[model samples]
Target: MDQTTLLLFIAATFVVAGFVKGVIGLGLPTIAVGILGVVMAPAQAAALLVIPNLVTNSWQLSGPKLKAIALRLWPMLAGTCLGTWAGAGLLEKAKDGSATLWLGVALVLYALVGLKAAKLRVPAAHEAWLGPVVGVLTGVSTAATGVFVLPAVPYLQALGFEKEELVQALGLSFIVSTVALAFGLIGAGALDWTIAGASLLALLPALAGMGVGQAIRQRISAATFKLCFFAGLLALGCYLVLRAMG
Candidate 1:
């Protein structure tokens, strides 16, 4: 394919990905990779998500929100760093089925455990493990099943965060994942100029989508959001399995 065509396609995909993320606060990587994986390798698809995720979420930084939650998420961030380092080696050795198979398994358990967990009020000290857990998965899967971060939300709510604080936390996590992912990809020598340029250009669509998503989020209820998000993720997981199997 020509440069223009590839650019157009990626831009379109990024826009949709950004919209989902903008509205739901967590679909950028999940939606983008599912589509990009159809055309590119998972590694390449991952490279595209890094910068955009960082850029969009960074725009969300309110003074009090950043100050308050960034401190609380410190433990999780440290865990994320460690998890990124450790998970990189395993990711290199891990083959096709590992992520999709486990993600499917994780999804089932998420349905069972996560439902109960989301309803309870858990303290931060108790659920602190979520960061490293999310980081390891994000690092390895390149954000494929990075929705692992989503489950941590219930625990955050249990800790009694308002909507803005919750949004900030999720946005900040995306920033951290983007940075960790950048380093991981660089170590793997996945950071060529062609991909970098493409990724930079792709941000335009991502920004546009984020605008649309922010607007949509207001119309949806939390339960409806979770249900729709789960259904979308299930379909994504199934598609990944088929791709790996084929």
Candidate 2:
């Protein structure tokens, strides 16, 4: 694609991604990375995600239980940082398209789980050990696929937080993941000034889309929209997998 075309494509992609997040309260990174992977390496797409994800998730850090949540989730967050750092070069090293393949697989699994809407409860006794393990796994996945919603999201859901708390926890985790991923990308030499600037520009369309999505949420059924979203994700995942294979 030409320069103008690429710019337009990126803007449109973020708009759609932001819309998804506004309606569902998550998915900006997943949607943006998955779609951008169609035109570039996962590492490059992930670099573009840093600014948008960080800025958007920062607002989610607010809430009364922020300190408690941080204290409770510190081990997991620490593990994410360590694991991401350790695996920071995976995407850059996977030069034979394996990174793209794994990205597709991650999207497919995430979409499937969302479609199933499975409910799992993690006993408090296991959390101490399990949280860090899940964090490491999530970080590794983020390093490899530029997406971090698999085990992390599921494990968080199983933590038994109330509705508001869960939302806040997710935002917190995403912020940590985004920051960790940014460092990982930088270490891999994938993030730089040009990509950072482009990511910043992408933020405007993303925020605009979020506004529109929030407006639409009041008029439509979230459950119905979620179903469609997962369905679309599944298709997109399949396409990515097939394209990578070909």
Candidate 3:
């Protein structure tokens, strides 16, 4: 794609991504990276994700529960960082197609789980062992696919956090994962100033779309929208998988 075309497509991607996030409170990076992977290399798509994911998640983390959540989740966060760092090494050595394949697989799995309304519970005492394991897997997934909602989200849900607390915890985990993923991308030499600059600029459209989505959310049923969103993701995932196989 030409420069202008690439820029417009990326901006559009984030707008859609942000709109979804505003409506349901998550999925910005996953949506963006998933769609963009169709047009570009996966590492490049991942590089484009760094700035928006970090900034938005940081804003989300500003809620009052930040400190307590951070304190409680530090061990998991540390394990995530280590896993991302290690996974980056693998990503650096692999072909871009591998990343794209992983992204597709993740989208399919996440969509299926969401559609099923799957839930699990973990006793508080088990968190110390379980959290780090989930964190490591989430980090590795992030490094491989630039999508971070795996065992992490499920594990967090299992922890029995209240709604608001869960939101804040998700934000904190995304922030930590985004930061770690950025470092991983850098270490793999997948990030450079050009992509970083474009990523920074994409924030405007994302936030604007968020505003639009927030307004829409007031009138529409979120459950319906989320169902539509997951359906789209499933279709997109299928396409990506097929293309990769070809």
lDDT of each: 0.65, 0.89, 0.84
Task: Say which prediction, candidate 1 or candidate 2, comes out ahead on lDDT.
Answer: 2
The candidate maximizing lDDT is: 2
TM-score of 2: 0.98
Residue-level error in angstroms, candidate 2, position 229: 0.6
In candidate 1, what are the lDDT values of residues 1-246, reduced to their tens digit? Answer: 688898788899999889877776776776786677666665677777767877877865665768868877776666665666555533333456454554444454444443444456655666567655644544444433433344444444566777788777777766776787667666766666777887787888999988987888888786676676667666666666666666
| TM-score (C-alpha, index-matched) for candidate 3 | 0.95
Superpose all Cα atoms of candidate 1 onto the true structure and report the RMSD in Å to 1 decimal.
3.5
* Candidate 2 ranges beyond 4 A from true positions: none
- Residue pairs with colliding backbones in model 3 are none
The residue pairs in collision within model 1 are 19-209, 23-213
Better of 2 and 3 by TM-score: 2
After superposition on all C-alphas, the RMSD of every candidate to the true structure, in Å, is 3.5, 0.9, 1.4
For model 1 the local lDDT of residue 145 reads 41
- Poorest stretch of ten by lDDT in candidate 2: 54-63
177-201, model 3: which lDDT tens digit per residue?
9899889888888887987997898
Error of 2 at 158 (Å): 0.8
What global local distance difference test value does model 2 have? 0.89
Superposed by TM-score, candidate 1 places the C-alpha of residue 41 at a distance from the truth, in angstroms, of 1.4
